[model samples]
Target: MVNPVPILQTIATETWIPAAWEDFLTFADDPTLVGGRFYYDQGEMRIEMSPLGSAHGRDNTIVSTLINLYAAMRSFPMQGFTNTTFRKSGLREFQPDLAFYIGEPGQTITFPARSNAAVNLNEFDPPSLVIEIAASSLEDDRTRKQALYQRAGIREYWVVDVNASQVIAVEPSKATQLRRSQVLPGLEIDWVDSALKRAQTEDDGAVSRWFLGLLTQ
Candidate 1:
């Protein structure tokens, strides 16, 4: 007897074929796709096979830096993970551009000492916050992924619109649009947009100082 190969259909650029959950996992395990993001909702899967563009990378770095700086300034317990996969078997999975375990869970989140291991959702709590930087996939991030994150029970979700230089922060459970973070209270959403725009012209140190000024205010 011979094992059958999983069927993979390329629906669009950066989109994965719809397959069974187990099949999607098997496909995702390809070594070439390492560091690549995979998202599964029910039987549908989307894989980001190409590397992130410069704009996407820049926005990701800027936002992550701002979040870390804010956490440090406020003495808030928060830890950010870059492209960490969170999988719940037979349901949904996501690898957001950035994810954070905030507050008490943020202080204690840990992973085994293996390199490049996906964080099993079955074993760990979902991140308190998940952010997607939208350079190309803005609509999907705001609509499909928004509902998916809510179903996964993430506390807060952010869609960073690179084109508009805006951040859409929301409490997934409440389904409310927000101007401030619920997980990291007093952190204004507008500040993130400003920082992202500033980073386009200013060096990181200058951006940090600007954020620090905001924090002090």
Candidate 2:
């Protein structure tokens, strides 16, 4: 993990002194560190990092590929907001494995863009969906993050078990009930398997077609 202090120091001395995350957002567009990580301190806030290959390459690739594919289809305007710090009530910053806002094309809803752009988590306008890819920290994904997203009012949460090729979709339930998903959808998370199968035979296009069909619907 990158040290949070040095990163914040660079931002303070050489770059703009970020009062809120707007500076960070605009700075994030810079080409020098387009795919690099940035760290910020929000007092009691948590620190987050975002690099092209921070997570397993496979996990990042799958998310980017799927989000890009969905965007290409023009299904909706999807924002792949990954590894950004958000300040919510009780907690300071809670980063998700993946975050996306899926809404109708050209239908830009007027939501309060945080002045600092460190998303106003108190508003409870969580991302439409938050995804967690399990690594060595399975419990972190399953419990702590799950509860965080729940209190943040996230509509959907998905835990993608990379090795097992299974995706668990979870949603809210009553106090006595276990949180689960009934209306949430599913996706075939085995792109590697599909690719391998296609490589051994001339069924690559067929496999892609099937997956694309599933994605589109």
Candidate 3:
């Protein structure tokens, strides 16, 4: 077998490579690709090996922070996972920028004992919400990844367009301009978007306080 690591390392980020599902899985298992994100759609596989830059990282942090804050303030049972892979053999897979199990599922979430391991789709249920921070991978995130999430039975999905500073929330079907969450009742998308915009300049502490106030009101 060819050593896939060096080849994978040389591939540019966000570039798609056509390979058999089994071969893609083999490449995915390589420990050297720890920070990379992977996707397998049909017979094509794409691996994003490039490191996340500051803007991407900032937006990711802001989004996760808002989710965590909302869950905490509302006493909504939720668990957040970052860069965790969700895989279904020979079909589809993704490592969402941020994923969450909400309500009963969130309260009762479980995973394998090993850290940084892929969550086998056959074993565990899909998350209530999956978020994609669309910095450079906007097209893939909106199209291919959105379809993949729907197929995986994800209840809600959000594509945070970093450039546009907008949140595209959707159910299993087509994407829509949502102002509230279907999965998390009473969680308003507009508030989330406002906080996201504020995060560009305001400190997280201030932004969090703003969220808390909204929850209390």
lDDT (0 to 1) per candidate = 0.83, 0.52, 0.81
Put down candidate 3 lDDT per residue, 1-217, tens digits, no spaces: 8654575655554866678988887678877777678888777888887667877887888889988887776677777898888888888888889998888423655643455567887888888899999988899888888888888888899999888777889886655546789877888888878988898899989988888888877
Off by over 4 Å in 3: 1-5, 9-13, 104-115, 174-177
Ranking by lDDT: 1, 3, 2
The 10-residue segment with the lowest total lDDT in model 1: 4-13
Model 3: lDDT of residue 95: 87
What global local distance difference test value does model 2 have? Answer: 0.52
lDDT head-to-head 1 vs 2, winner: 1
Give per-residue CA lDDT, model 1, range 1-217, as digits (tens).
9865433443443654567888787657777557667899967888876667878888899999998988888777876899878878888889999998888423655542335677878877898899999977898898888888999999999999988888999998888999999888889998999998998899889999999998897
Error of 2 at 88 (Å): 1.5
Clashing pairs in 3: none
Candidate 1 versus the native: TM-score? 0.88
C-alpha-based local distance difference test score of model 1 = 0.83
lDDT for residue 129 in candidate 1, whole number 0-100: 92
> Pairs clashing in candidate 1?
none
Q: With candidate 2 superimposed using the best TM-score fit, by how many Å does residue 158's alpha carbon deviate from the native? A: 0.9
For each of the candidates, give the backbone clash count: 0, 1, 0
